[model samples]
Every structure is written in structure tokens, then in C-alpha cells.
Target: MTTTSHSNRDLRDEIRDYWSDRAATFDNDPGHKISAGAELFAWANLFRRHLGAANGRSLLDLASGTGEIALLCKELGFAVTGLDWAEPMLERARSKAPEVTFLQADAERTMLPDASFDVIVTRHLVWTLIDPKAAFAEWRRLLKPGGKILIVDGDFVSRNWLTRMIERFSGSTSHGMVSRHQDIVARVYFNRGARSEAVASLLLEAGFENLRIDNRLSAIHRAQAHLFSWRKSLLRRSEHRYAISASAPMTTKE
Candidate 1:
């Protein structure tokens, strides 16, 4: 699949359709859902530890498929809004968490009001962005002064020959979105080598401050390898994943 052959609109539509098709079974995937009680507790604790007090904080869960993180935030007492482009995915999210607002919008170009959210969270989303820098800017614009953006992502495609061989065999057993769109995976800019420093720099360029990378999420994933084994099995899977946090500067009121 040559990127040159497809227009930007075409690529966007393909991505939307790809995610829409996977919406029905998305939560069924072990890595995507917090099904077990222990897993749920661990994830809740992780969010609490990072996000601090959730009371009165407004959270925007970008690319919030099936309301996983959004629902979690709602449960934690934060006013939550789930945003995604795929209607089918939003539909599932709405079904699961009707109390939380779910909007169908582009993550890179949300027409939402500036500085509206106290916190922004996204998981497994950055790699799919056509322009991560632009997306970061948009996210920064959406955050309130002192607001934080938490991202969970990793480099999924840049790998050695042995890893590629392993992925090929692993993908054969998984039916996730990454496995079905190997071509898109190869073309994604972030998949090339989106390191932590590079992403932090992008955030800084977008006017975000106090950048930090948390490896606890990665450690949890590593401990429960089977929980995310499907991701590794995918042809376009990340070798490692971590969480990044950056805060919008506090505005000075004259």
C-alpha cells in the first residue's frame, strides 16, 4: 500500500473504517479491557496515583474506544468526555458508560473550546496519528492552565529481523486491528522511531511543560505478558509501551 496513491482523506477514512469494524470485538480483547477484578483495581490505582484528586476535574479521553479509560475516570469521580472519530466505537462506549459524554470528533482537529479540560488521556492512539505534532498542539489547546495530558503509547513497528519474524508468526494467531493493517502500520510516522525524548520535545514545542515518562504501566504490562500478548502477536505491535505526562503552563491573569 503506497501512501502516495492515497489522499489524506482516503487514509483517514481507511483508519476510521478499520477502527469501526473492530469496535464490536474491541473490549473482548484482554489487553483492551479490564475484565478481572485484580486488573481493574490495579489500573484504578494507577490512575489515582497519577491523576491525583479527580473531584471536579474535567477529563477528555481522546480516542476513547469502548469507554475504557473514560468510564474509569467517571468512576473515579471526574467529569468525563470520551472522544473518537469512529461512530461504532463511540456507540459501544456510550452503551457502556452512558453517564459520560461521548463525542465523535477527530483527535487531531477537535473543534472544542480551548482550555476546556483539566486532564486529557489517550491510550494506544499516538501511533495511528497522521500528524502527531499537530495532534499534540491540538491537545495542548484543549487543556486548561496547569492541565495535564497523559499518553500511553510505544514504538510498534521499528524492530530487528528476529522481532519481525516473531511478529509475523504471532500476528497469524491474532485478529486485532494492527494485524489487519500492516500496510498502514508501516507508513505511520510514529512507528518509525517515536522515542520518549522525541515525544517530550514535541509536547514542549506544543507549549506543554513538566514532561515526565512513567514506566510503571510498562512494568505492569511486562509482568502480565499474556494480558498484552495479542499486541505482540500483531504484525504491527509495539515491543514496549509507556505512559507520558505533560502539563499545560498555568495562565497568568492580569
Candidate 2:
């Protein structure tokens, strides 16, 4: 398939179309869910531990495809809202968890109220976004003071020749092959490299503070990944460095 060079809007359109096409089969794909493994389980356990407890808080799951992460948060005692652009994905999420709220909305331009959520979680959505810097700014804007944001996604662990062959052979065995392969291409197009420092810098540019990168694999998840957790701080310099222009408002922390 030929991918045209795209501007930001063009990229968003492509992503929206791509997800819309695959929305029905989104969950069944091996790429969507984490499989069982000691490393994955331990990682999830650690992630939960780091999150403290959801306990009656409100969570906004941005780009929540099948509501898996949102449901997890809901199970942890959060009143959860699953938001995504694809209607079919929301439908599937609602079917799986009728009690939770699932809304069709763009991750970059959601119709959600400002400063509404206590926690914002996005799984594998960053790579799908055309303007992640803007998305992160929006995530910061939607969060209450000191609210937490967790982004769980892949990282560049060196791929060996054998790994490549195994991955190629295993492609037919998983749905994630398509989504993830596309993501790798997109990442290379958007960011020159996949490094914690590069991701952290982008977060900082988007006004996220106290950035931390957590890389832990356990038996509970299928993908070995990297997670970035950051807090919004209530401080500012005279001028925002990464803002699009002087007209754009600086994101107020909290």
C-alpha cells in the first residue's frame, strides 16, 4: 500500500479512516490485548502500584478502542469515560461494558469539559496521533491540578535478524501486526528516533512536568513496552517555548 506524504490534517484523516476500517476487528487482533507472561503481569502489577488507586476518581481513556484499559480503570473503582473517533470501537466497548460511558470523539479535539478528569490514560494512541504535541497539551488542559497522565506504548528495542524472521512468520498469527507495523512507520516519519529522551522532550514541550519513563515487561501483557508518566505542574516561564505562536495560550498546569 502506498501512503501519501501527509500534512497534519491529512495524517489525521488517514488515521481516522484506517481505524474506522479496522474498528470491528480491533479487539480480536493479537496486537490489541496484552498476552499473559510473567514479565507482563509484573509490569501491570507495578503500573497499578504506581497509579496508587483509582478509587472513585474519574478517568478519561483517550483513544479507548475496545475499552479494555478503561474497563480496567473502572474495575479499579474509577468512573470511566472511553473516548475515540471510531464509532464501531465505541460500540464494541459499550457492548463489553454497558455501565461505562463511551463517546465518539477525536483525541486531539475532544468535546470534553476542561479540567474534568482526575486521570487520563492512553494506550498505543500516541503513535496514531498526527500532532502528539498538541494532543499532549490537550490532555494537560483536560486534567485537574496534579492529575496524572499515563501513556503506554512501544519502544525501540533493537530488532535482530532472527527476531525479524519470527515477526514476519508470526504476522499471520496476530492482528497487532498490522496496527503495530503501521505505527512503526508513522513514528519514524514523525520522530527521527524512538528514545525515552525524545518522547520526554515532546512531553515537556507540551507542558508536562516531572516526566518519568517506565519500561517493564511482565507475563500479564503481550507487548514489551515503555510507559511515560508525567504530572502537570502549576508553574510557567515568561514565554512558552513550544507554543505554536504568540496567539496560542500557554497551557496552565492543572
Candidate 3:
């Protein structure tokens, strides 16, 4: 049997409770849902286009709080399992979309069977992870032979038009600093820049192939938020061929 230390379990519970309170306000607030409308739509479209066909596809939505993206996937014709460690968030998600399966589970450690999903997606959950490579590996384990994993997050060095607009509209560097701080302090997520790269690298190390990054430029032009997408490779034999070295840890700050 596997187990987590009591302290660690307590910490996880605390974080989950916090997010539950924040979830309802998350989308309504500007800072919370910056790229939500256009950027998220683009991401969905990108996934649809590359996904080839969505009817009856099995999807794993990691960190699936309140079931926003999972609901969208169900609407788009995919069978989705919404996973999160928070009961409150999962409860809200269930209330909103009872048709979807919402499970309270850890993103890093899942109880699902291996090679079970066609696509695995997580949004803005990179920073909170202590070991993203391990998280990716877990997702990889749950993905089928020809499955794909999509991660949506932001990079520090990669700034789009909306960032510039925010800087201009805010006027003072103080305002920009506030925005930056939000990225860092929000429930322990990694800030932009190499954090996103580190995530992709982790997926690559975990036997994922054909990795693609989409930094939302079109939405940025539309005065929307900046966003990026990381896609995993789909090949049976190729997974072993692409595994990241377990002996040497991958570091983003390094």
C-alpha cells in the first residue's frame, strides 16, 4: 500500500480548501481569468484541430477545479474525468456539471489505471508542483500508447501584447509588480519564464514526443491574456525512446 505522511496530507487539504473558496471568484475576477475567454477558446480549438477526432475520446483533466475545461471537453464530445485534490472544488464542479465525472484525487499521484486516457490536460498548475517531472510521468502513465498530454501555462520571458497593454494601462511599475506577485504567490504556482519550459521538458523526459508550445499571440493582439500549450507525443515504442533521465533531475531555474 502507498501512503503520504500526515503533515503532507494536511498541507494538501489546506490548499484544497483555499482553492475552493477562490474558485467561484476566480473566473469573475480579471486577475483570475485573464486569458480565459479568448485564450482558452483558442486552446480548445487547437486541441480540437490536432486531436483529429473528439467523439468518444477519453480525457483526463488534471487539477480540474470546478470543471470549467472538463465541461467544455464534454460539450466537445469527449468523455472526461475531472481530477483534483479538493473536495470543495469537486463539489462545485459536480453541482455545475453532474453529467461529468469529478473525482477528488491528487494530480501528482493518481489511482487510475495506466495508459487509460487519450489526452491529459492541466491549466496553471505548474507552479504548485514540487516535482513537475514526476507529475508529468504520472500523467504519462495514465495515457494510452498513442495518447497526448496538453499543459496550459505561462512563461516569464515570453511576453505577449496584452502584457504590454497591462503595463501601459496600469501606468506605474507598481501595478506590474502587483501582477507579477500574483503569479508567484497564487497558491504556490511557478512564475512565468522557464517554468513553462521546465514543464515541457518534464513531459519530454517522461517518454512524450512531438512536443509543441503555443504562446497565445492572436489573443494577445485582441487585448487578451498570454497563454501557452504543451502537447505530448503519441507513439508506443517511442515512449521508452523518449524517457527523461531518472538519474539526473531536470531543473527549470538551472
Candidate topping lDDT = 1
| Candidate with the greatest TM-score versus the true structure | 1
How many residue pairs clash in model 2? 15
Instruction: Point out where model 3 deviates above 4 Å.
Output: 1-11, 31-43, 156-194, 220-254
lDDT of 3 by residue, 1-254 (tens): 13445645655666666676666655663323435567567546756654656878898888887777788788778989999887777887888789998888889888899777877777666656645667777877787776767665554333456555444554344465456445434434343343545666666777777766655334323333222111111111111111111111222553
Tens-place lDDT digits, model 2, residues 37-119:
54345545654755667778888888988877777777668889999888878888898789999988889889678888877
Task: Point out where model 1 deviates above 4 Å.
Answer: 1-6, 171-180, 222-238
Q: Give lDDT tens digits, candidate 1, residues 158-250.
A: 687767777567635455655668866666667576666777788889888888887676434544555655545443334556778889999
Best-to-worst ranking by TM-score? 1, 2, 3
Which sequence of candidate numbers ranks them by lDDT, best first? 1, 2, 3
In candidate 3, how many Å is residue 162 off? 11
Please identify which of the two predictions, 2 or 3, would achieve the higher TM-score against the true structure: 2
**With candidate 3 superimposed using the best TM-score fit, by how many Å does residue 120's alpha carbon deviate from the native?**
0.8
